[model samples]
Target: MRTQIAIVGGGPAGLLLSQLLNRVGISTVVLERKSRDYVLSRIRAGVLEWGTVELLRTAGVGERMDHEGMPHDGCYLAHDGRMFRVDFRDACGRQVMVYGQTEMTRDLYAAQDAMGATIIHDAEEVALHELDGEAPFVTWTHDGKPFRLDCDFVAGCDGFHGVSRPSIPKEVRREFEKVYPFGWLGVLSHTPPLADELIYASHERGFALASMRNPNLSRYYIQVPLTDHVEDWSDDAFWQELKRRLPEEVAERLVTGPSIEKSIAPLRSFVSEPMRWGKLFLCGDAAHIVPPTGAKGLNLAVSDVHYLAEALKLFYSSGDGSALDGYSEQALSRVWKAMRFSWWMTTLMHRFTEHNAYERRMQDTELAFLECSAAAQAVMAENYTGLPY
Candidate 1:
């Protein structure tokens, strides 16, 4: 089989890329290792940066999101038993939408079907060949039968564990990573959210975030040691711990319910340099990973798609490869800025014992500044709402 681009994953990043290309008369085939139902069942982050929402609308998949997603103009920050709001719209003229990733993925799938794009589920042993050459191809097996797919380019959107990054020779690849000492123990339940907007709290005990998918579906997370497991916390225990970290007033109104989903994700800042390797351009988690503090992972991946899609479209139209040649350096500039922001937010909100007295004092001073200084709040608002693509 032949296509213009062969996408190696069917997650939001891969599917959205294919959707954008389809609008411009580009043909793509998406290969997924799991069934469609399995992919939609995964509970992931719900925060959507404004830029991401715009991208979806341009791709013709934002109709449902516009109707169902909640919009937040600002969020609250709690420190020293006090909560203060940072108005993103006033500070940056932008606001984010609270649309769950699962829902967004569903919309993309519906858009793909409406457009008649090809997506193969249950694909196994997906492999990329000759990425450094002009005529690259992908191979995979379905129901024990092998097939070959040839394309002019390949998008390695299969995520962190996928083969796209490993395909780059170790001699040419450089990786940078910092693993934090803690993880986020997240719980989802069908209870009313405690606040109108998200609340990120930092107390002597640790960090806790009160978020939501909608009015009734609440998503909350608390910091835990790296060794902690999901089985360690029962629903009652999680609710109690979360209430303890919140302000007294907010805790008084908090609603608790049985958790429908529970999981733990380690915090880390990682980046693989040179996002492009010949014809294989890595996007999203494949190229870098940021802690969830900044809500940048999914948004970053879509940004990569935006840039890569623009470059590829121009190249195919005018027969110029300069944009493709500069894709790595251009994308890295934005990636590093986001990495710094995520690391900064994580440090400010999370409890780190490794900090000395001076470092701890500095953290307290920084939070205090953010509370009173309009400039600091503006910076946070711009970063949280997202930087220019």
Candidate 2:
């Protein structure tokens, strides 16, 4: 099989890139090792930047999102039983939508299928070719038959573990990483949210977050030791900890159904410089990863692919590789900014024993400023809701 562009990984980045390219009359093929159902059902980051929502709407895939996703104008930061609302709407005149990443994938998948784009799922032994050359393609097996895809260019939206980034020469690539001592133990349940907006609580007990997937389902997370195991948390124990962490008033309304799912994700911030190498380009988690505190993971993925789609369009039409050449540097500028924001959020809200008396007092001072000063609140609001893509 041959196409103009061969996309590796059918996650949001690859799928969205294929969709955007297809819309502009560029032919592409997407390869994935998992089934379409699996891709559509993977739960991930939900908060959508206002610009991201607009892009999806313009791309003809935002109808269901607009219908089912709740608009959050702001979020609450709670500390020592006090609530400080950061009004994103007031700060930037834009509101974020609380919709699950699964829903976004479904929308994109449906749109791509309807447009007759090529998306191969359940393909095994997927391998990349020509990583060091001007031409690159994917080789895989589908239904026990060997197949090869030859394309003009390759896009590695395959994520951090995929072959895309590893293809870059190690000597030339620079990697920056920081692993945190904490992780988030998240639970999904069939309960309505305790509040309309997300609540980020920095309690003496721990850090807790109250978020909603929709009106009928809620998602919550608590900070835990990075080495903690999921089996260590019992349902009853989870609820008791939640109650201790949340504000008194909010805790009263909190209700959890049997946990439909639970897992712990380690917190880390990593960035790989130079997102492009030759005709191959990397986007999304393949190039950078941010801790979940800022809710920037999926949004950054969307932003990277959006810029990529635009660049690819110009490349395919005019043969001017300027955009592709600058993809890494351009995307990294925004990626690093988000990395800083997520790191700041994680450190400011979570407790650390190593913190001295002065360091401990500084957190309280920062929270007080965020609560009382309009300027401080505005800064939080802007970063929380997101910076313009």
Candidate 3:
């Protein structure tokens, strides 16, 4: 098989890249290890930044989102039993949309199919080769049949476990990692939202986030030990701990029904330097992962694919590789900026016992200052809602 580009994963990154390319009359193939349903239903990021929503709307996938998605002007910062809101619309002329990753995946999947793009699901044992040769090779097995795929370029949209990064020469690869002591125990329930906008609460007990997947479905998360098991946390146990962190005034309103599903995700910051090597490029979690506090993961993935699609379009149109050549550095500039924002938000809400009493007191002061100062609110609003993509 041959294509202009071979996308290694069918997640949002891969699908979006394929869609953009197809728009410009480029052919690509997407290979996914998971089945189509699994990829569309995966529970993941639910917040869509304004920039991402705009991009999706331009790509013709935002009609459903614009109709079904809930818009939030800002989020609430609840600490010490007090709540203050930072109005993103007022500060930055931007607002976030409460659209789940699954929905975006489904939309893109439909768009890709409508455009007549090739998507191979349940692919197994995929491998990349000839990265240094004139043409790159992608090989995979599906249903016990092995096949070889050749393409001009390969995109490793696969997640962290994908082999794209590992294919890099050991001597040329550089890695940066930071693992947190905490993880988020997330839950999805069929309950009306307790709040109109998401509430990010910081308490002595732990960190809690209240968000919505839709008008009738709510998605929430609470910080827990990294080693905690999802099975070990019973329904009663989940609510008991959640009540401690969430504001008491809003606790009663947060309806806890028989949970539809639950899971625990370890918090970590991971980055693989140089998102591109030879004929292969990485996007989304494949290149870097940001903690979920800032809701940047899904948005970052869209941005990466946006830049990548534009670069490829230019490459084919003008026969210049300048845009592709600068892909890594250009993407890194925004990646690092988002990294800082996510890290700051994580530390501000999460408990760190390593801090001395004086440091703790200083943190409290900073929070209080941020709550009242317009300048500080503007900073959070711009980063939270997103900057121009």
Candidate 4:
């Protein structure tokens, strides 16, 4: 098969990129290792930066989101038994949409189908060929048969463990990583949210987040040790532990129920530099990762798509590669800023093994400063809503 662009993953990044490109008369194919059902079943971050919402709309997939997604103007930060709200709209003239990533993926898939874009799922052993040269292609297996895809450029949206990033020669690629000492034990349930907007609590015990997919479905997470497993905590136990970490008032009114889904996710901050290496470019988790504390995961993917999609359009239209040439640098500039914000939020909210009393006090002090100072609140709001594309 021949196409203008070959996308290595069918997740939100790859699908969104394909949808965006196809809308502009570009032909692209998406190859996914997992089944479509498997991809949609994966639950991910729900917070959406305003820019991400706009991108989804531009991709022709935002109708459902705009209809069903809740708009959040502020979120609460709880520290030392009191909670303060950061008004994002007031501070930065922007608000985020609380739409689950799973829903976003479904919308993208529907849009792709409407556009008649080619998306091949259950593709296995995908490999890149001659990405360093002018001509590049992708090879993979589907239903025990081998297939080859010829394309002008390859996009590696396959994620952290996917083959696309590793295809770049190790001698040419440099990675920076930091694994946090804790993980997030998340619980999903069909219960009313504990509050109108999300609450991020920083307590002496640990950190806890109260979020929602809709008014009837809620998602919550509490910091845990790396050693904890899903079997180690029951729904009742998880609720008890979570309550202990939240403020008394919020806890008193909090609703508890059986967890529909439960999992533990390790926190980490990682980045792979030079997102573009020759004809192959990396997007989203293929190139970087951030802790969930900052809700930057999917937003980062959208931003990368913004840069790469625009660059590819320019390349195909005017035969100019300047934007394409600057994809890596342009994407990395925003990537590093987001990485810093996620790291800072993780450090301020979670309890670390090495945190001394001084460090704990420092966290509380920072929260206090954030509550009292409009400048600090604006800074947080700006970063939380998103930086820019």
- Report the number of the highest-lDDT candidate: 4
Which 10 consecutive residues of model 1 have the lowest summed lDDT? 355-364
Q: Who is ahead in lDDT, 1 or 3?
A: 1
Ranking by lDDT: 4, 1, 3, 2
Judging by TM-score, tell me the better candidate of 2 and 3.
Answer: 3
Clashes of each: 0, 0, 0, 0
Give the candidates in order of TM-score, highest first: 4, 1, 3, 2
Kindly provide the TM-score of model 2 when superposed on the true structure, using C-alpha atoms: 0.97
Alpha-carbon lDDT, every model: 0.94, 0.88, 0.89, 0.95
Which digits, one per residue and each the tens of the lDDT, describe model 1 over residues 298-333? 999999999999999999899999999999988898
lDDT of 1 at 247: 90
How well does model 2 score by local distance difference test?
Answer: 0.88
Model 4: residues with Cα > 4 Å off, grouped in runs: none
Off by over 4 Å in 1: none
TM per prediction: 0.99, 0.97, 0.98, 0.99
Candidate 2 lDDT tens digits, 173-280:
899999888889999989999899999999876799999899889999999987789999997888889888998988987987789989999888999988888778
> Please, what's the RMSD in Å of model 2?
1.2
